[model samples]
Target: MSFQSLQLAPELDQALATLQFSVPTPIQQQSIPLVLEGHDLLATAQTGTGKTAAFMLPILHRLLKEPEHNGKVRALVLAPTRELAQQVAANSEAYAQYTGLKVACIYGGANISPQEKALKAGVDVVVATPGRLLDHLLKGTLKLDKVSHLVFDEADRMLDMGFIGEIKRIMRHLPEQRQTLLFSATLDEQVQKLAAQWLAKPQRVGVDPENSAAEKVEQLFYAVDDDRKRELMSHLIGKNNWQQVLIFTRTKNMADEYAKELNKDGLPTLAIHGDKSQGARDKALAQFKSGKTRVLVATDVAARGIDIVDLNYVINAQLPFVAEDYIHRIGRTGRAGKAGMALSLVSIDEQWLLEELEVLLDERLTPQWLQGYEPDLTKVPKDNRKNSAKARKQRDKKHILGKRDQRRRKK
Candidate 1:
């Protein structure tokens, strides 16, 4: 359905029109009305599902309706990483442009003095990371007494990062009577516990099942030796002439090393990770986004906040340790309903990790061997092959039993 049917404010409707956002995504269609109705909400949707707008539009509308000038922070949005905070703040600014709302994004790894100044100047909405927001709160640079709306964007990620204590501390500062919204890519046990504690009789909205990647993403993997991963990646990019690619590595050092190797092979590349300063990270991101750098190598921590328009390729130079992160990594591509490709370069050592990812995805990923770079399967550890064979037999047995049961039912 069109966004107009959601009954957004006139100014918001104008903003949406200007942004060419006419149709609502599934998450937006289901959650916007519930949020506008003043109910606390618990939503689980995959990345690239327009979840930011689902909450931002309604929050901006509520702030405009109330018109609070006292400036004690009417709406607080807590993101897990600096990049995500910046993205949410950007979206908030765009959607609230016509309404004349003040938006400030605060996160660590940057100059906090300026953030403190912005908070002092007064803002209707504050999007911040948990650690940095707590710093401001403890330093008496910000207040949440007037906060009527609270949002935990990427709640699962925050919990994974061990920010649960910080989030709980931040919650203590907000007024007891408020509308709370928790948006997560997955509603696992940890997220459920957080919701139980925070939300007050919330409306549940789930657009897609947990651990599912975007339907438009074409997922495939290349089998190579650990030492040949970089060589294989370089060959694929050069052979395919990939213009803009976001590559995920498991560690900061790998991200830097991969970017350097790719650049040495005549590909303009940049690396972003936690070790880099905020200015450096921003510069690298801007370069990648502008196509000045054709490749951006990033670790899981640094990659959380990357939201680029038309980013068509996401390469897993190294598979994530957590299976769910595989979903988030590929999600960087296949955004805004566009077709995209997610390629993983799997080595012998990463076979176990790939198997875990397949279990989470509930489907087997067929492995492809590059013509010249095919891995030496004979060198794979005997134990690994044995385990793989055993797992395959179990799956075959289960499939045969299911088929037999279906035949019996028909008879």
Candidate 2:
């Protein structure tokens, strides 16, 4: 359906037409109306499904209709990561371009002075990460009593990142009388509980099934030895002449090491992770988006907000420990109805992960053996005593005890 049919304001209509957005996505079509009617909403949607615009457009419309009361914050959107926060802020700005509405993006890894200045300038909307937003609240740089529309974009990711406490703290500052929207890719038990607590007679919208991958993406699995997986990646990239690829690694060190080794072999690769400064991460992403970098190796958290249109390939250098994350990784590609490829290199040790993913996906995933990198089927996966779950728990206990002792000595 046409966006104009949604009864949006003239300003929003102009913005959509200027951006060449004539038709509303399914999620947008279902969500925009409920939000405009002042109903709390619990929406189940995936990335690249136009979910941002689903909530942003209606909020912008509502903000335009209601006169600002003392120029206080009228809307607040909380994202899981700084990158996702930036993405949502960008989209909000573009949507509010014609309406003269101001948006402030607050997050960590940068100077807080600038964010403080923006809040002092009086913004109509604030998009932020949970931790940094709390910092602003504690510093009295931001207030939320006037917030009429509250959004928890990617609620599942925020919970996965362990922001439950921060979210609860931030909620204590908001007015109970407001419109709330909770969007999640997966409506797991935790997400449902959050909805039950926050929403009041909400409209439930599910655009896609849970744990479902994009329909346009072609999924391929290859069995390669753990050590030879990198070689196989290089071979496939060169043989397929892939122009730009986003590869996901399991850890920060692995991302850095993969980029290093790939660049040493003349592949223009870059790595992005939490360890890098904000400026460095932005630069790497800009380079990759501009086609200057051939490949970008990243951890799951680091790759949260990457939205590359027409991105053809995504390589999972290593399978993720959590099966649901595989959906998030591949969702980066095959966006906006474009065809994409998700290639997973599974080693003998990681072969078990495939079973978990298959079970969640409700489909049997077929794996093919690469000619030269075939693994020994008879060999049992090696177990490292140091990396065992029990060992990790022990280390965590000792670390906590050490910190407690240090604090006691200081006191």
Candidate 3:
């Protein structure tokens, strides 16, 4: 159904039409009506399912009818990362432009002075990262006492990034009586607990099955030795003629090293990580998104902020320790109903990570043996590597130990 059927205001309809968004995404289709009806919502959908607009539209509609008073924050959107906060702010601005709604963004890594100035000027909507917003609260620069609508975009990621404490702290500041919406790609037990604590009889809406990747993405894994991973990557990129590739490494140093190696091989490559200045990260991201650079190597932190359309491939140079991250990594490709590919080079050391990822996906990844890149069977695999079946058992062992340690620490 079209966005108009959701009973949005005429200005919002015009905004959607002007932006050429004629058809609503599945998440938007399911969640918009419930949000418009003034109910708290917990929605689970993949990253690129237009989940941002689902809540944004309804919030915009509410704001349009309400009067904006000085020092009153009507809507507050808490994002996990600076990039996400900026993105939400941009979306808010785009959707609210027609109604002349004022939007302000607050996040770390920029001048606090400017953000403080904006908050004092009184914006109708504030898109902020939890930590930075808390900073404003402590400094008496921002107030959430008047906030009537709240959104925790990327709720799972916020928890992963250790923002749970900040999120709970923010809750204390917000009026107990308000509309709360928590959206995530997946809702784990922790997220569920938060939902129980925060949302009031919320409507639970999930457009797709939990932790399912897009059908358009062709996922493949290559078995290669740790030493030969870089070689395999260069060969695959050359053989496949991949124009735009997003490569994920486990660490910042690895990202930089791989990018340098790829550049030396005549492929224009760049790396984005926490070590680099924000200016450098932004520049590299722009080049990669514009397709001016053929390869962009990034650590997990860098991956969260960079969004490119029609990205052809995502290469996992080093698998993530967290299983959910595997889903988000491949998600960078296959966005906006587009076909894409996710290729992973798994060394002997990362077999356990691989197994956990497979369990999370509920499907084993098909191993494709590339010619000349086959793993050596003669050598005993390192301690870090275990066969897929063994890996699951190992993970369980660790979990048991972790629980024991928690109890001991408490005692």
Tens digits of per-residue lDDT, candidate 1, 1-411, equal 899988889999999999999999999999999999999999998788899999999999898889586766899999999999999999999999899889999999999999999999899999999999999999999999999999999998887788988988998899999999999987677788899998999999998877688889999999888889999888888999998999999999999999999999999999999999999999999999999999999999898879986999999999887667888899898888899999999988777667756656667887799899999978855356654554355444433111212222333
Task: Itemize residue pairs with steric clashes in candidate 2.
Answer: none
Q: Which candidate gets the maximum TM-score versus the true structure?
A: 3
CA-lDDT, candidates in order: 0.87, 0.87, 0.83
Candidate 3 lDDT tens digits, 333-376: 88888889999998777777777666667666666788888999
Worst 10 residues of 3 by lDDT: 399-408
Which runs in model 1 stand beyond 4 Å of their true positions?
Answer: 67-69, 380-411
| Whole-structure CA lDDT of model 3 | 0.83
lDDT of 2 by residue, 35-84 (tens): 99999999988788999999999999999889897768999999999899
TM-score of 3: 0.93
| CA lDDT, candidate 1, residue 246 | 94
The Cα error of candidate 3 at residue 37, in Å, is 0.6
lDDT of 2 at 172: 98
Q: What TM-score does model 1 achieve against the real structure?
A: 0.93
